[model samples]
Target chain A: MRDASEPGALPTPGGPRVRLLDADSAPLLVRDHFAGGDPGPIVASLAQVPELVGPTLPFLGAVLGPSWIPLREKEIVILRTSAVMGCRYCTDTHTVVALDSGLGRDEVRALRGDLPVAGAFSDAYERALISWCDAVAFGIESDIRPARAALDADDARVVELTLLVATTVMLNRYATALGLPVSVDARARLAEEAL
Target chain B: MTALATALADESLGGRVWFYTNYHCNLTCSYCLTESGPKVARRELDRATVLDLAREAKDLGFSQIGITGGEPFLVTDLPELLAELAGVLPVLVLTNGTLFQRALLDRIAPLGDADVSLQISLDHPDPVANDVMRGPENFRKVVEAVPALLALGIAVRIATTLEDGDADDLPRLCILHRSLGVGDEDHVVRPILRRGRAETGDMGVRARYLDLPPELTITADGAFWSPFAPTVRGGSLDTDLLLSRTVRPLQRPVDAMITVLSGRPEGADSTLNIR
Candidate 1:
């Protein structure tokens, strides 16, 4: 079994420090690394290193809001992209959120193509979104071009933000590949809950 | 089968239905299947039309209904619409978590009484990574909204997208979920859809199949489906009923129904036994 306390532990030049939190049930030793002294400088220095698989919630909020895209489409794109990328972490995490967003077992299942396309997404717009997701996943940029072309001036800005949202899948895949531990809260939730 | 046959069979069994409120979405993901958002509105389903459809679905025996869109929250009267639907059938609203407002929550919170659930999507557990994917600021917004939903005593779940090497990264994602205040008791993990960008080249479909259990079903859209046919077009009356029957029987004592529903054929040992 893996050591839960040292989930993503790394040995630095000075000593050992926990890098990522493990999902397993184990007590986290927060003060162990800083016990020797105040490691403010070290912590600050670590912050300089860009996180490969970081979070995107803040960015999403600022760019997209009430007037443009709804939460459902945003999440559907995220989850669909993650699914296309084949990132389990992204898939699992988004599945929970998708549920909270009001997708039930059937709709969630339908998201994976369980239901017929004719009945799955009720509108052409949604079908277009799903198609665009496929184009990006398959490296078919041209597919999204039409959708981009169809946008009006204001909606076009939202489309730009959508591109950024799509990019997250790339980062998510990279982070998962590198073996960074999930955050503490995510681990606890997965352990006790279904996600 | 023809579309009509599919619809008839679908209607006979009374399965779940989805309503896309609009083609607009807040984010533009690279691998989106529908090319949703920005400039696509050929068929926008307004709340009234959706309610009419919902009533039809209920009459047809559908127990669950989903409200989807570029962002359902973007619809001005979404909470009211959800409220209306709650009176008839259980409703699930899919969202990105950026548009969850207090007023909406206040209106919809009471509707969770055995007939409603909210699903939020947060791609990456790490702030930087999530922000980078969703834009430069989404990470904070989603994180902030999570606590708000939880505070309402509303059930919240996080949906993370899975890519080729995500299984190895599961540990980190779990940690991230907890850090974001989502507990294991509160969420479920789901696989990413494979029909999009991930399908380009030989995106390692074999690797994705490795972690999945035997008998796991994968959708044509590339999501891990449980007990159902591989494609939505492949669904039939018999298939739907079979899925409903086999799902519960196939689940392990500790397995979640949703997990089973999201099962895929990737990564399963051929010889392993499934209930």
Candidate 2:
């Protein structure tokens, strides 16, 4: 069986519930979207339903793309959200992105819940962000107070961070439920970084 | 050039401008996408609008123009409209093939010399089986029209809209279309989509925006996502696929579609892999 990191291999124990479409057979609009290179497994899987690509991608970009939150903080929320949700595809894929965005290996591992956050996150805001993500991901209403208090009182920052975490959580479920595979490039980068 | 023009120039994306010429047809096909029949309201795109859009489409980098309707031939001056539109870009008109009596065929015979082709619908090899979905005498009319249209030196293509159980008839349909002077290359076979009149039936495939490609289709109502977008169900138009209400400036809807396409994060590559 192909490993999780193989180009077309699904990370799930079995495989993807839906077939991924390659550039050759994908619709013209889809091909237009991934013109620079072959689409990642997440996109290819969604290509099975081409119409979803238009609405889904733009919404995904708005939620996860450049926003009021810093890249490091955004990755923190995303990693913790995926980790708590147990989405291997997103956890592994975003690990590479988090690292490329300047997150330390220990910080990345800690965010993925492989290690405790004692020394990994030195910033109070980051620590609070992680707690908020965990609280949100697990749907624990009471556990959100300490984190919300420690995080700054900037309403915009809190909302942006909350939406980021929420969107990542939704993506984690989608990627996990679909049994999407980690790309070979992302997997190689993860290995190289020893994460 | 604008972002929309640049996107349209990519041949792989299939930048075809479509016009919904009219919305009334002679027959009430069971699976008509627009629910076009003799009794349906005639929401037509006039000749001037088509010619104007064609000119704008050519300037905007669209490669071809497609004209569809409940039936395009029902438009009194479709041949002249087609000639004007074809002068701007290659043209394809979708028709039921049932309207080509001697006089109408003679009128459209001039299209043979223009950069235009007609795609006529023929669902089955057996006339009875085909007419069951398309209406009575459909198969005979298409069979007769293909030879007559071809004799006028016009290009003809046969489109087969198949139901789930109709796969067995394809080989026979191919042979039938070939015998009528249409080559195998000119035969189009696709699943009848569950839209408009076919929505209540289990005979066609389910269609959704996510599953369908974005083609800039302009109707009398507005610009649509695809020719399949401006559908009529229960005597009301389905707005699920309407792109923009203002299509006159042409840039309005083209930009709307471009805005939607630009949301893809993977970005675009340069290659005309699809035609």
- For each candidate, give its TM-score against the true structure: 0.40, 0.57
lDDT of 2 by residue, B103-143 (tens): 99888888889989999999899989999998999888889
Tell me candidate 1's fraction of native contacts, as a decimal between 0 and 1: 0.00
TM-score of chain B of 1: 0.63
lDDT of 1 by residue, A44-67 (tens): 122212121112333534543333
TM-score of chain B of 2: 0.94
* Candidate 2 CAPRI grade: incorrect
Give residue B38's lDDT in candidate 2 (0 to 100). Answer: 99
Provide the TM-score of chain B versus the true chain B for each model in turn.
0.63, 0.94
Query: Using DockQ as the measure, which candidate wins?
Result: 2
Q: What TM-score does prediction 1 earn?
A: 0.40
Model 2, A123-187: lDDT tens digits are 87678778888987887768777668777758888887788888888888888888887776776
- What are the chain A TM-scores of the candidates, in order? 0.56, 0.90
Collision count for each candidate, in order: 150, 9
